[model samples]
Target chain A: MRITALAGGVGGARFLRGLRTHLDRSPGLADTELTIIGNTGDDISLFGLRVCPDLDTLLYTLGGGIHEGQGWGRADESHRLLGELAAYGAVPQWFTLGDLDFGTHVVRSQWLGQGLSLSEVTTRLARRWGLPDQRITLLPMSDSPVETHVVVEDEDGQRAIHFQEWWVRYQASIPAQRFQAVGMDRATAAPGVLDAIRGADVVLLPPSNPVVSIGIILGVPGVRDALRGTTAPVVGVSPLIGGMPVRGHADACLAAIGVESTAAAVAGLYEDFLDGWLVAPEDEASVRLPRATVRSRPLLMTDTDAAADIAGAALDLARELAA
Target chain B: MRITALAGGVGGARFLRGLRTHLDRSPGLADTELTIIGNTGDDISLFGLRVCPDLDTLLYTLGGGIHEGQGWGRADESHRLLGELAAYGAVPQWFTLGDLDFGTHVVRSQWLGQGLSLSEVTTRLARRWGLPDQRITLLPMSDSPVETHVVVEDEDGQRAIHFQEWWVRYQASIPAQRFQAVGMDRATAAPGVLDAIRGADVVLLPPSNPVVSIGIILGVPGVRDALRGTTAPVVGVSPLIGGMPVRGHADACLAAIGVESTAAAVAGLYEDFLDGWLVAPEDEASVRLPRATVRSRPLLMTDTDAAADIAGAALDLARELAA
Candidate 1:
């Protein structure tokens, strides 16, 4: 089956890792072509270099070169460049460029500047890293620039902060009033983005930030409409399991969007498009959706094996919906 | 007394290292200010990050953090970031970037993007690196972008390549017809470049690439004018010891510019502005100069002490001219 997944950064990367592992292990699922539509809202320009955080995280993790300890950047990372940057009084000191990761950004930025679309650049990067050919395709949400900005009221006053500062710099400590994907209103889905969704036999939404990750992708023109009208079952895994996020500042983002941190609220957000919803067994009572048939399963991806098992369960639910 | 020095990358950095030692040990030069005018001809935009090769070399060397073995970059350097860059297929792979040195480039690029002058950025970077207050003022030749391009013709075709590609990638293996500083004609000298020369008590040119390094600096508007009019004696140490460069592809550059790789040929280039010329003792028999008084010395800087001795001999020549 051709399964397409929509992803953010950490959570999306983790879920994709599991899905990849599951496909590799399952005898019948070996032919599954996985196309990942990644959110580029978290992308930013730093030191005059374009940095796509989510795309890099996905690339590094899938390529087997991720820094396991930091859970981001390349393995055996060095801070020599970052130290020099700091010494030069570079602002927004919190967002660091690991030496190994800087290379990726530099290459990506160079290719982008040379008039290659994000999708084309991504394919080239993936090919260079020796990623499995034709089995998995990683697509940025749009070729156009779209930033996730957070409206916050700090002691200094109200202002819109870039997503990186709101997340990495402030660590989400301040009260955020709303999360806005700045240019999403005018952004058309990158070439092949909507097509990937329409062509897939199954579409899986991993437990990623709804307001920024999948939400930003859906916010792109015609993307949500395509997903809603697709004949294939669109399944979503709850970002909230037992009233808490699996990782990251999802709770804060959830609060910013005024959604209670619960599986039901998350399911409700995707209700119109979701044909199936998977929630952790502990949050079985919270699974209430009108359009989607909700199923409760063991959803904690604590390890690679556990993650694969979770992915398998989701695929099984999708198969049941197909039946 | 205030001294001005013209420099390139490794050789220039080494000479300055020795010069600093000499000045530090001299009782009469206890309060002397040293201003270094560094060559930015080797500067290139890699992956869109501005890298000033010669300036970083000088900074790392004078700041007591240079890689002793390489005579460039920082000691205890790591290639973690560079390895990652390669993994992403960055072009011009021959010019390696150590993790520590990358920090300097990142900071400078960041500041440059924010509209800071190269001189101002250099000062801030030098301060951050704990360079002694007022001990040395490093100046780039021009704030405007100027890249040294070598016009090479081979059996198949002919094209002008960037200095980095010619030196690092091809290692100057090809025969070159000419050397051109692509933007020099319209470029103005960087702020404080002329002022440093105008205010100097003595001006010394290190054994750097005469054609690309010192030559490019002179090509900048007002630089040669400042040197010609300065009351301070302008003296140059021969980069060509016998009939060859001590390091780098200076010989190829010299050939490209139709100048023989000889001490006298190098000294002749600065004849109009120079007051004294320092050539290696071996090349004294071949040396001939009318505009400047020629002096013979052991010019090879084998170690810090040797470098200091060379600096001392050059300064002594300047002192003799003043007397």
Candidate 2:
């Protein structure tokens, strides 16, 4: 079975960890091929080097080099590079770029400078992590530069900052007016992104940020149409469990888009394409989406085992909806 | 006093340390302005970053960040970036790029990509090290790219490899046919280079690699003529002592150029423009240059004190010649 998924950073990577564990243990599912369509909305260029945060999270997490404690970056990373950059008063010092992590960005930036597309560069990086040999393919939503910016009202006036600044630096302390994925209008889905959705046995949407993660992927031209038109069942796990995000600044981003931080509200945004929706048992009462199979389960991914159980629930829901 | 110096990497940096120490301790030389014309032939672009080995050596050494034992790079440097880079199978893993050093390259490469001349970029970097505030200026031999390539016979037939590959990786084991500083003919002296020589109270050549280091500096257009015509005496300290190079691959490089590794042979290369020469006391008997004021001293720069003593001797010789 080929499972196509969309992801962002930490939250999505953790959920996928569950799915990977589930796929490994499930009988007759040993041949499962995983295809991840990662969010490129968080991509930014610092000091002329292109940094793809979401793709790197997936690479580090799935490849087993991730800092298990922080849920992102290399395990043995050092911030010497970032510290040195800050000493020079280089801009945007808030976004933490570790020395070990900088190596990947350096290589990717060099390859991209030589005319390779984001997809090609991501593949090369993934290959370094032995992901391709594991039969897991990770692709960016689009080759085009699609950076998510957060519009916030500051002391001076309203201004837009890169999503990372709002998310990582400020901890989303200031109220966000809106979220914009710049350049999304012209970005076509990268090669194999549409195909993965169109031909997959199941399309799973991990619990990545909806306003900027999966939302940016769906904003790509022809992607929403492909998701709605695909023969495969589309299932999603709510990023929010009990009226709060399991991790990250998803709730703040959701509030900016005027969406209630509830599993039901989160699923309602995907009602047009979702064939199945998984919510926490406690939040099941609030969700009432039609056409999609509404299932409730223990959604807190406290461990890989818990994540596998949640992954199993999502996959079973998809199988039932298809039946 | 205004002193202009020509230099390379390790040896030059050590000599400059001594020179700086000497100026600091001398009663009337407290306000001495030092200008260094550093060799650019060893500069190479790695992973799209412009790595300037000599300039960085000067910066780290003089600015008090140099690795004391190695005479290059930052102290307390971490190799995490290089280790990660190697894991990705990035080529030329033989070259060690510490995390701290990579930061300088990133800033420089970005500045260069933004159309800043290398001299301007070097100034910016030196300012980060507070070099300008110290009344010391470091200029590249030329603003233009002039990488030294060592031509050698190999199993794949005769081919040119970067000087770093020959020096660092092969340890200059392969017999070099010739050292070619590609693009040397067109490279103009960087701004302030000619003026530094013309306005110099004294022009001093440190014990750098005479062939690839000081030799390439003179190869720049009008530099040798400036040295010959300048009213200030041109004095050189031999890198060789007791018929052997004090440090580095100078012996192999000289051998490749058909020059014997002797203080006398090395002085002959500088005879046309040299006004004074310093050889070790042991090798003074073998020297035969007639026009220059020949002197003997303890030439090995074993420590900053030794370097300062050597610097004093070179300055004294230049003063004697001027008298």
Candidate 3:
């Protein structure tokens, strides 16, 4: 079976890690291909280099080079560069660029300046990291620049800030009015992005932020339309469990969009295209999902083995819907 | 009094350290304005980021932040970035970029891309380093890119190689034919370069590589002419003492240029413009200067104090000529 997964950052990376593990162990799932369409809204220009945080997370996680503890960047990282940049009074100083990770951005920036598309540049970077051929194909949502900004009201009144500054710098301390994906109105889906969804036997949306992660992908022209028209079953795993985010500030983002931080609310956002929904057993009693067949299970992926179990359960649900 | 100094890498840096120390203590030299025109012939672009060896040497040395033992870069530099870049098979693996130093290059490369001249960029970078307010001005020979290449005869016949590859990569093991400043024919001196010479009370050349370092500076259009016409006395300290170069591949470059490595031979190269020459006592017997007055002294600056003594002696010679 050819499976296409729509993913964001940490949560999506964890789910993909589990899915890969399950596929590797299943004897009957031979010749299965995984294509991951990653969100690029969190991309930023840092220290005069282009840094795609979400894409790097996915690449490092799948290529077996991610930091096991932080769940992002490269393992065995150093902060010598970060310290120097700080000394120079670089703005938006909260996010750390580990020494090992800066090399990736350096190469990407150089290649991008040389007239290569983000997708082509990503392929070259993945090849350098020793990613397996045909096992996983990573694609960015668009080649053009798209940034996620947060409009917030603090003691100084209302203003818009880059997603990184709002998320990493402020630690989501202020009240957010709304989340905006700047430049998405005119943005076209990257080459092969729509085709990946159209050709897949099943589509999986991992447990990533609904408003900024998956919602940003849906905001691109014709992407949500593509999902609605696809014949394959589209499944979404809830990022929220027990009224809180699994990790990071997903609740803050949900609040920005005026949506309650509940599995039911998240499911409603994707109900038009989703055919199956997976939620935690705790939230199964109160959740009201439309049209989509809802399934309750242990949604937490505490380890690689546990994550594979969750991925296997999601795949089984998709298979039952197809039958 | 205005003082002009010509410098190269580590050895010249050490001499300037002494020169600064001496000037700080001298009663009459408290208001002396020092102008250091660093050699840019050793500059190269690695992975699309400019790496300026000589200018960085001067910056770190005068800024009091250079590694004491290594004589270049930050004191607590780390190479995590270079190791990662190597894993990606980046070419020209000889020169390493410390993580801290990489930030400097990224800023410089960004400014250069935005149409800033090298002189303007250097001024900005110096300000970030917390340099004294106009205590010293560092200028590149020209804002235009000019690289010194070494013509070497290997088993594959003669080929012109970049100066860094010749010195750092090959360690100057092969026989070289000539040293050529590739873009000097059409290059103009950077703004303020000619004015610095004309306004100076004395011009002193430190013991830098005569062929590649000081030679490339003179190769720029109007620079040599300015030196010849300046009312200020121009004096040069020998990079060679007792028929041998003090440090680096100066001897190899001298061989390539068909000049025997000796104090008198180096003096002959500067005879048309220079008014005085400083040599070590050991080479006093062989010294034969035509236009410049020659003086023999203990020319080796073993420490900061020793470097100041050498600078004092050079200034005394200039003052005597003025009297």
Candidate 4:
């Protein structure tokens, strides 16, 4: 079986990791080829080094190197590099990059500077994480630099800042007027991105931020079209639980797009192609859809086993729809 | 009073740091402005980030962050970043950069990418190291990217490799045919480099590598002329003791250029402009010069205090020459 999933940072990475765990334990499913299309809209250049937050998160989480407590970055991390950068008074001190994590950015920047596309650089990075050995192929949504910029109004007046500045620095407290994928128009889907979706047995959207993660991937020129055109059943696990995000600022993100913070509203965003929707038990009654089957399950993903069960439920729903 | 010095990496940084210490304790000399023109030919792009071995050595030493045991790099440094890079199979893993040291390259690369000249970047780095507060100005020999490439014949056949690969990786064991300053033809002296040389009350040469360090600096346009035209007496501390260097592969570097590893031979390279030459007592007998004063002293910088005394002796010689 082939599974293609669109993922963001922590939440998406966690869900996909759980999906991998589920596949590994299930008989006959161990050979499944999983192609993850990671959101690159969160990509930022810090200290002239390219940082792909979502892709790195997936790499770390899946490779067993993740800071489990924080749910992103590397385990056994040190901040000495960051401490030195701070002492030098280099700007944007808010987004903390560990010494180990810096290794990724430095090599990625080096490879990219050497004229390799993001896909090529990411492939090299993934190889280091043993992603290929696990039958995982993680590709950025697009090779073109697509950064999500958040438009926010504050005492300083209206301004557009990189999504990370708003998300990591300001904690998204600053009301975002809207989100902008700065280079989406020029971005073409990374090689295999469209094919992964079009050729997959099942397509899953993890519990990633709707506005900046999956939504940003959807904005990639041919991505949404592929989803609508693909014959595979498209399943989505709701990022929200009882009108609030399980993680991150999905509610605030939905508000910026004028969408209600509800499972039904999120499903509505993908109504054209969505085949099945997985929601929290509390949100089951309110998330009814005419074209898609809505299923209720405990979506908290409190642990890896819980996450595996949730992911398995989503896959089951997709399989039922396909049948 | 204005004092300028030419420098390389470890030896130069140690001597200059000692010079600063000596100046601080000497009455009336405490206020003297010291300008250091550091060699940049040793600069290399590692992992696609600018790595200035000599300049960083100067900064870390003068800033009180140097690894005392190694006489270069940051104290209490961790190799976590380098470890990660190695895991990713990034090339040129021979020259290791510590986590704390990476902070310097990252910011410098970022600033350079933003179109800041190397001199400007060095100034900012110096500020963080409190060089400005100590009235110390560290200038790269030239703003242009001049790299020293060593031509060596090995089992791989004759090829020109980066100076660092020869020096650090091979430990200069591979006999060098000759040394080439790859971009020196188009290199101009960085701003203030010529001024520092010509306008100083005293000019001193630290016991750095003669062929690769001080020699490369002299290759910059107008620098040799400025040294010759300067009203200030030019004094040099011999890098060799009894025809042998105390540290580093200076003899091998000298051999590459067909120059004998002797104090007198080294002074001959500066014969046109040298005013005073400081050599070890054993080498004093052989280093007689017609135009330049020869002074004998213990050339070994065994510790900080010894380095200070040696630097102070060089200054005294310059003062005597001026008088």
User: Individual DockQ of the candidates?
Assistant: 0.69, 0.73, 0.63, 0.92
Among residues 3 or more apart in sequence or in different chains, the pairs in candidate 4 whose N, CA or C atoms overlap within 3 Å are: none
lDDT of 1 by residue, B217-301 (tens): 8888899999999999998899987888988888888888788888888887898898999998999989889889899988888
Per-residue alpha-carbon lDDT of candidate 2 for residues B83-124, written as tens digits (9 for 90 to 100): 887888777788889999999999899889889999999998
Better of 3 and 4 by DockQ: 4
Top-scoring candidate (lDDT):
4
DockQ of 4: 0.92
* Interface CA RMSD, all predictions: 1.8, 0.9, 1.5, 0.5
Shift of residue A129 alpha carbon in model 4, Å: 1.1
Q: Candidate 4, residues A1-323: lDDT per residue as tens digits?
A: 99999999999988988999999999999999999999999999998999999999999999999999999899999999888889989988999999999999999999999999999999998999999999999999999999999999999999999999999999999999999999988999999999999999999999999889999999999999999999999999999999999779999999999999999999999999999999999999898899999999899988999999999999999999989
Tens-digit per-residue lDDT, B188-281, candidate 4: 9999999998899999999999999999999999999999999999999999999998988999988888899999999999999999999999
lDDT of 1 at B245: 90
The C-alpha stretches of model 1 lying farther than 4 A from their native spots are A132-134, B131-134
Mind giving the per-residue lDDT tens digits that candidate 1 earns over A212-235?
888888888988898998888998
Best by DockQ: 4
Stretches > 4 Å off in candidate 4: none
Q: Candidate 1 deviates by what RMSD?
A: 2.2
Report lDDT per candidate. 0.86, 0.90, 0.86, 0.94
| lDDT of candidate 3 at residue B321, scale 0 to 100 | 74
Looking at model 4, residue B305 earns an lDDT score of: 97
Question: If you superpose only chain B onto the true chain B, what TM-score does each candidate give?
Answer: 0.97, 0.98, 0.97, 0.99
